[model samples]
Target: MDLGGNRRGVDMGPYAVRASGLYGMLKDLGHSVTDGGNIPVPVPEEIGVGA
Candidate 1:
């Protein structure tokens, strides 16, 4: 989460990491990679200010 930051699109970090072949790279190194998938988070519109 962006926390108190005013930046938008910071949430896209996860997507960028996955697109960078992180899982594939780990597996190639003999590491087990299991994707638990993204956790469900409410969008900004679904949350009220100060909530």
Candidate 2:
């Protein structure tokens, strides 16, 4: 949901959280970990962010 702003790399927040072992940590605590996967975001060119 981070689009059209001064925040670069904010779009990678989900990936970063997943890479930080969020699923593993949750599973370790005896919780079901079902990854829904990343949401699709439009490219800059697609939405004309800075172009």
Report how far off residue 50 is in candidate 1 (Å).
Answer: 16
Q: Which candidate tops TM-score?
A: 1
What is every candidate's alpha-carbon RMSD to the true fold?
3.7, 4.8
Clashes of 1: 0
lDDT of candidate 1 over 1-51, digit per residue (tens): 665669998878878779999989999999999877778867778899999
Clashes (backbone N, CA, C under 3 Å), per candidate, total 0, 0
lDDT score of residue 5 within candidate 1: 64
Model 2 lDDT tens row, 3-22: 67688888788788788998
Instruction: Give me the runs in candidate 1 sitting further than 4 Å from their true place.
Output: 1-9, 43-51
Worst 10 residues of 1 by lDDT: 1-10
Which candidate gets the maximum lDDT versus the true structure?
1
